[model samples]
Target chain A: MKIGVLVSEGPYTHQASDSAYNFVKAAIEKGHEIYRVFFYHDGVNNATRLTEPPRDDRNIVNRWSELSKQHNLDLVVCIAAAQRRGIMDANEAKRQGKDADNLAEGFRISGLGQLVEAGIQCDRLVTFGD
Target chain B: MFTSSENIDPDDEGGVIKKFMFVNRKAPYGTIYALEGLEVVLISAAFEQDVSLAFVDDGVYELKKGQDTKALGQKNFSPTYRALEGYDIEKLYVERESMEFRGLTEDDLLVDVQIVSAAEMADLMVEQDVVISF
Candidate 1:
């Protein structure tokens, strides 16, 4: 099934995003396609490219990037949510005149319309939230 | 969107299909999800689709009983959920595990809904042709 996942929580802060991450990996391993991963609310923090975890710990942000790289998945972070939380891509960082861009590659910044579109285009939409 | 004689299904796969599920996961007032979820349901219902909403995790607060938004400085949308039935969106489901984890029983909720197990909830998601989560 074509699936889109909403990650509104954290993988490191708690179990919600971690579970969601595992679900995405497992779904991909089972030969399902992930249409997109929509990050909203606090979920936008998952896109922060500067996240650096200990060597022994799981690098969730890197994992998200790797997931997108491996599957060529659509990783869209809500622009409204991302900007408000200071999560910016190259364009947004340039527009905001920020020193750095936190939104990693393989992810795009968009509005909720994309999420609505994912709903219409994908077969299933699952949410992982706090 | 208003209903008409002609067929219309915005959430339909190809034709004017019925039934759309919206999964909401957020506090009622803090995030825009609670309101957006209602809008989707209303709009889909106007398109003449069978609309059902599910609440999991913090989303369950969208249906907590005895809500007083005045203290939180937020508009009470709990009442809006009551109007869902008027829109023909009566199939509201609450995750049993979420309720249990949060210590919220049916009595603590704003409306009466079917309590679905984790596996059942997952199946319900898989059963939907179009599912949107917020």
Candidate 2:
């Protein structure tokens, strides 16, 4: 099935980021086509290049980068939300005249059209949340 | 009648808008639901949806007055709810029993909001063509 996964909560917070990593891995192992993984709300924090997880744990930020790189997956962060929360690419940082670019590589800042487009493009839209 | 997949008729201007109901059910300080709910509400309004936001359980925290996130160094979205009316997505409602359970009264909220019983909120939910929860 072509799937669009919505992550809105705690896989990026108090719990481990393993949930995000395993979610991508499991979907691939199941032979599913992931059309897009949309980051909204606090999920945008997961795409921040500044995340520094412990040395023993699997780095979910790096995992997302690999998944996006290897599969050419569309990793989108809502641009408006990203801006307010201080998560942005270099171009966005320059445009907003902010000194820092915090958004991780392999993730693009976009809009709701991508979410709506994923809904139309995918066979199923599964959400992973709090 | 034009469903979501159908084209809008030039003569029927009101028919062109997509109607959306957002059900928000989490507390404001701990979860991201409130922020995302407002985000989707604004985005749906941008797409020209006749959007309404209904609060239940701890979701009532979204409208509480004197919200201060500066102490935590978090971005304060409390101000954004005020901007909803500007987006034309102003139908915000709350469940009466939920407000009571949370020890909140209508005046505790920042904006002028409607209060409805859970039963009435359920009825409104059915009227929406697309119901999205946050």
Interface RMSD of each: 8.3, 8.7
Candidate 2's C-alpha runs over 4 A off are: A10-12, A15-17, A98-100, A116-124, B1-20, B26-36, B61-93, B103-134
Q: What is the C-alpha RMSD of each candidate to the true structure, in Å?
A: 6.7, 6.7
- Model 2, range A1-130, lDDT digits (tens) per residue? 8888766653446332356557767988899888888877667777888888789976778788888898898888877667668898998789879888987889988776566445445666665665
Could you give candidate 1's per-residue lDDT for residues B12-42 as a string of tens digits? 5464453578888888887776765565566
- For each candidate, the DockQ is 0.10, 0.11
Tens digit per residue, CA lDDT, model 2, B1-134: 01121222223334455456788888777766777677666656545656788999889988899998888887888888887888787799999999999899988998878999999999998887556678
The interface RMSD for candidate 2 is 8.7
Which run of 10 residues does model 1 chain B get worst, by summed lDDT?
Answer: B1-10
lDDT of each: 0.77, 0.74
Q: Supply candidate 1's per-residue lDDT for A6.
A: 81
- Chain B vs. true chain B: TM-score for each candidate? 0.85, 0.85
